[model samples]
Target: MQSCFFSTSRTTNDGSNETDQEGSNKLSKDKSIKKNLLHENIYTIPNFLTFTRLVSAPVVGYWVLQGNYTDASILFGIACVTDGLDGWIARRFNMQSIVGTIIDPMADKTLMTILTVTLAMQSLIPIPIAGIILGRDAGLILASFYYRYISLPEPKTFKRYWDFSIPSAEVRPTMISKVNTAIQMGYICLSLLAPVFDFTGHIGLDYLGYTCAATTIWSGASYVYTKDAVRILHPPSNIKK
Candidate 1:
């Protein structure tokens, strides 16, 4: 009688195992469908705006190199405005993506690199200044790669005013970056207006350019340093939490 009871229990367990396998298959199929749908919707409106800014970089560079400062300044301003707008739209509409975060900053860096190098070559800004800015930018890029390889965890929150003030943990861009960008744009606009309005005599374009360059170097350094601090403060061990 005991043997017969054990045989019945074994059959019951096998039936339950088959039911679980069937449920798991259905769940996996549902997840695959959802992933495909998400992949198709990656290109949101905010991302489109970012791509537009990336595309405008070369056009602005061309205008500036041709001595068309006014057009270049106008286009530069438009691109800057779009950068802000893209972030706002993404957050407002819940359209943010990992791709957008990566692409948006890359676009800004590429635009700044092109403009800064072109300006330096044209003698609008000093080469040393461009070198410093470029070096800092390059360092940040390398640091990013390092962080990824080490599997750095993301911050719980984006608000870090104290962290922004420090040079080492400034991995995240702050309002200072926006101000630096604005000053650079102003320098470019003033350089264009100097020939037309004879403002070079009153306010030299070279001086303005130098100021912008100084700020760029300072901000870039701050960012790189702060990022390092942040990494140290919250190392890989904290990732498990």
Candidate 2:
């Protein structure tokens, strides 16, 4: 009778042990699944910062259209700072995402292009300045098309230290591109502020505008030249030689 009792007790303990182990395994799997889902979701803090810039673009445009240069300048400055902050946060925190990459630059180009056109329409800035900025942007677009069609190279999957390929092909933004953006943003803010602060008549605005124009040209040219050189040196094997 005692042997029968001992056997029964042992069986019960064994079954309990098995159930506990299974539960532990399931918990671990659940945690791992949650972690993977979190990583795939792109709503990080840095991306939030980028979103702020996107939101500000329309507000800035509205203010400009309303002839409120002062408020527009302030909002533009905030957007510019947010751009820098988001990038710095992403790099520092390793929070870079494909969405952030696309939205950040799009927000910048949209805001600047709208402001440039609006200012020109108001005769606040010289038509020549707006023309030069637009011309550089158009040239970059053309070069991008040429690279895509004429130079059909194998898609590079990795970025090198000195690689400056356009982000449409690969999602990485070049350091020089970031610098150029910063300079352009600075110029826009200053230009907008000049009239609000009664500095439009001063010679400084002209000098700054000229400097901004030159930088735009140089940066655009460099982008095209770098992409062309990379395509030549590292043509994708899939592309015909």
Candidate 3:
């Protein structure tokens, strides 16, 4: 009877060990799945279109500096078309992605920055207007960096910081922000084409510039006051309960 009791205790201990091993394995699998969900597929047609704009921005800047307005205008027009098309395609086809949200504005800002700087250098865009546009964008960019850092999960290394696949925050542009971007793009487009058409000193362009400035300031303020402008996808581990 004593030997039988010892044998029964041994079996119970073995069963408990198996249960512990199963729990550990399940926990490990859950972590792996969670990590996989963090990384999204960033390659899509919309992304490709947005990428094209990023590539074209510098070329447009070079042309503007070189006084090659005709080709610059053509390429800029194409870039603008792709910009709208990509967004539409993304929505229509359910190809929306977190990376697209980041890069689309990035492409827009890159193009606008290059053109604004080059045009300002040539005295096409008023210095004050350029400053306003640049300043607003700079502030937003800095805010984006802050949001990204705070929203990122723990172990935030440099590699993870730059990894767009691991989306930390999603930016939702405000209504005024959308309007501001549209006005800014229109103003820039006209500025790019004015030289080609010999409308450099047109009073209408001046009015557009003033409108752009107003919208730019308004939109920047909207982002500041709007609580939902940037949504945190995954708060840092420290921030989590």
Candidate 4:
């Protein structure tokens, strides 16, 4: 009878041990799944809106270059609207992502670059002002590449580097940078529609150009001096030693 009692006790303990082990494995899997979800939540509504801006950029530029000002103005208006809407949605609905930080500015820069060049080609904006805007964007683009490379995690291959899901850095636009972007956008939108309203040679447009140039310079300098403009989340594997 004692032997039977001992055997029963051993069987019960073995079953309990197996149950505990399974529970631990299940918990670990759950934690891993949650971590991945938090790491790569890129398909949010704000991101989609931002994507629309990207797609609209080249179309707006094409229309501008083809002398389709009315269509270009309409598309530019839509782009501007999406630009503001995306940021608002991101803030309002808590759908912000690291990818949003990277691509939002990217879309803005792309639009600015295309329009700046096209408008310059048409002599809508002063050549010097266009050069200033393009130059500042060029410098910022170079800095972004360097920061991204240095902040990326181990095995920084081309694919992973472009894979924004593996976010390694966050870009917090400086106050001056934000103002500069708004001013720049307004200037570009007005430039696109100037022909429609016969406002091409207005003195106000020249004043706007001067303001845009000043803000462009100030904002570029702000990025240089601002300590927390770019935050590196992961130290590069190259310097892991």
Candidate 5:
């Protein structure tokens, strides 16, 4: 009888031990899954650089407004360099994210627009020229939003706006756009340097400014004239069969 009782007790304990191990394994698996989901993917090198540039926007504006062009130019140079660095890291490391795509351009636009507007208001740069650049950027922003809204899954409610969908809004700067960006930054830097070094006697700053303005208008006009912008603005209508 004692032997029979001992055998039953051993069987019960064995089953309980097996169940505990299984439960532990399941808990561990759940923890691992959660860790994977919440990993620090956003803290990548490229994103960090982009974030730094974004933060520099306000600081650059403050310096420009304070009449401290020297420091402003310094920080602006860092912003421009980081812009390229982040892009390079993103492409080389395959660490691109939708958030990066949105934030990167946003940071650039913020920096450029804020500095230009502040300087223009101070009568340091041409107001009409700044208007053109700002206007172009504003249009692109609206177009991006318009394209993005169409890409979402439509509601089941009886509605037919369009059939096709773009995956995401892409910010593909054309060759001229890229050149314009470089010249734009260069002109801003030179403008800032003019105050520090006194270049009123020369027309270098004016020359660069005119070039930047021309490129800005040309790039913007190219977008409008090209079919790309129109297609993005007006998606194809859904044809119900």
Candidate 6:
């Protein structure tokens, strides 16, 4: 997640609604909340662009798998451009939202994850490199949801899909994590370009693979070892000591 990894502060609604509500009440409340959030945040230009990037992920990966490097590279570049533009617009125009904060990196991650898998399947990238990226992200995502579930009151009956607040301010990115993402993106771009065009001697897509793996692992470990993420996710309640 290139976006902010840490929320500014920690908060908890310790209150609980143990009693069940009527299905109608639950559905109406869910619809009402979704209506409000979408009305307030979904219509923004930055978010719209972000959504475009999200939509582009599968298309980009499909092109890669089909061995259409030209189209894949072009679509990937467009997605990256849209990502950059959304961030700039959001910050420049003060259009930032909790939704943006969460979805921005999610879009990036989704695109990269899909691309990585597709490329790895085609042997463009090493399995270990792909593993590091996917593994770290997979674990972290589950962790994010776990923490969010712990921090909020999960509805008994399903309603809105986007009614998640777990990817909150606290779930932020680190400097190295951000750099790792950039390098991974760069590596993918270079990898795709290598097939279509000639590049200089040793553009280092190979060596960069190891670098990404190490950094991805370290970034995940750093989050827990540095006590920033673990304290928030697990806390001291379960500590035997």
Please report how far candidate 5 places residue 194 from its true position, in Å. 1.1
Error of 6 at 27 (Å): 25
Q: Rate the local accuracy (lDDT) of all candidates.
A: 0.66, 0.66, 0.91, 0.88, 0.72, 0.73
lDDT of 3 by residue, 1-241 (tens): 4775443323355456555666689878777667666878888999999999999999999999999999999999999999999999999999999989999999999999999999999899999999999999999999999998998876788999999998889999999999999999999999999999999979999999999999999999999899999998863353222
Model 3 Cα shift for residue 70 (angstroms): 0.7
Q: Give the runs in model 4 whose Cα sits over 4 Å from its true position.
A: 1-12, 15-38, 235-241
Find the 10 residues in a row with the least total lDDT in model 4: 5-14
lDDT of 3: 0.91
TM-score of each: 0.65, 0.63, 0.86, 0.85, 0.69, 0.72
Residue by residue across 1-241, what tens digits does model 1's lDDT show?
4775442322245466555566689878767754442233546899899999999999988987898877887888899899999999999999866556556887888888788777767776668777876876788678765544343234323342122221122134656676787786677556545655666534566677678777877777676556433333332331232
Candidate topping lDDT: 3
lDDT of 5: 0.72
lDDT per residue as tens, model 5, 125-238:
878878887888898778766656664334422233221221234455667777888898887767667778888435878888888989988887776666554232222343
RMSD in angstroms, all models?
Answer: 9.0, 11.4, 4.7, 5.8, 11.3, 14.0
- Candidate 2 structure quality by residue, lDDT tens digits, 66-90: 8899889888878878878988999
Candidate 5 stretches with Cα past 4 Å from truth are 1-43, 154-167, 227-241
TM-score of 4: 0.85
What TM-score does prediction 5 earn?
Answer: 0.69
The candidate, 1 or 6, that scores higher on lDDT is 6
Ten-residue stretch with the least lDDT total in model 3: 5-14
Candidate 1, poorest ten consecutive residues by summed lDDT = 161-170
